[model samples]
Target: MKKVNIIYWSGTGNTEAMANAIAEGAKIDEVEVSLLAVNQASADHVVNSDVLALGCPSMGQEVLEEAEMEPFVESIESVVKGKKLALFGSYGWGDGEWMRNWVERMENCGAQLIDDEGLMANNEPDDEAITNCKELGEKLAKA
Candidate 1:
């Protein structure tokens, strides 16, 4: 069974909701799915997982959660080479530059992103956003 690890940082629980939705959709009978916070997840987990789903809300100036997520992602950049990756997040304001730039970074590191453009929901995820997140998870699991 392939392992799917979802690691995320959520300040207001918005991103965590999205993470669970994605995890729910990605669950397959043959795969092991684990959803974890940035504090509990490590670069080794990201490197070892068959599928990696990273989620974080846009922080000040539209960047990743610096305190934890940024450092974790930085540590895994080289380890993610040729890995199947998926990204999703929640934003309170501004455009979805954070998600876009994050996707580009993953691409630059030679990771295969499941979605050409990763999913981003403004503030709390609506029904449609949740649906999209689930689909993203399913796609990542299938990959």
Candidate 2:
């Protein structure tokens, strides 16, 4: 079975909801899923997983949560080379430039992103967005 890890940082729970939905979708594909807060996720888990789904909301002028997620991301830079990765997040504003930049950074680090990118807006997650999040998870599992 494929093992997938979802690591996320959420200030107001929107991104957490998205992460759970992603895991649910991956489960439909019979993938073993581990959902962890950014602080709870370890480098070993990331290195051992077949797929990685990373989530974080836009914070501080359209950037990643710096306290935990940033450090976790840095730690995975060398380990994630050639690994399948998916990025998802919620943004309050600023045109989702953060997600784009993040995806680009991961790509530059040699991690293969499964699709274009995943971004939801604000605090409310609509049905279509949730479905997209789930589909993203399913695709990552299949990849």
Candidate 3:
């Protein structure tokens, strides 16, 4: 079975909700999925997975959460080359620029993003955003 690891960091729980929804959608016959918080995950999880999904909210200045998510992202940079990746997050302000920048960074690192543009939700995700996240998860699983 193909293995998928979803790692995330959420400050206000919006991103965590997205992560759970993604996990729910990733459930399939041929795939095994694991959802973990950033503190409970390590680079090895990404290295060992057939698919990796990462979630984090857009923090100050439209950047990734610096405390844990940023460091975790940096840790996976070298290993993510050629890996299938999916990114999703929630934002309170701005035009989802953080997700765009993250997608670009992953692409530059050679990771194959399931969606060229990562998914984003403003504040708490509405029904549509959750559906989109699930779709992104399905794509990640199939990739």
Error of 2 at 53 (Å): 0.5
- Count backbone overlaps in model 3: 0
- Per-candidate TM-scores read 0.97, 0.94, 0.97
lDDT of 3 by residue, 48-130 (tens): 99999999998989899998999999999999999999888999869998999999999999998888788888999999999
Clash number for each model: 0, 0, 0
Error of 1 at 123 (Å): 0.5
Estimate candidate 2's alpha-carbon lDDT, on a 0 to 1 scale: 0.86
lDDT of each: 0.92, 0.86, 0.92
Residues 20-121, candidate 1, lDDT per residue (tens digit)?
999999898888899999999988898789999999999978899999999999999989999998998999868899988999999999999988788899
Please give the distance, in angstroms, between residue 128's alpha carbon in candidate 2 and its true position after superposition: 1.1
Per-residue alpha-carbon lDDT of candidate 2 for residues 1-143, written as tens digits (9 for 90 to 100): 88999999998999998998898888865689999998787899889999988999988888899999898899889899998889998987578888988999999999988875655656657788788888887887788
Error of 1 at 76 (Å): 0.4
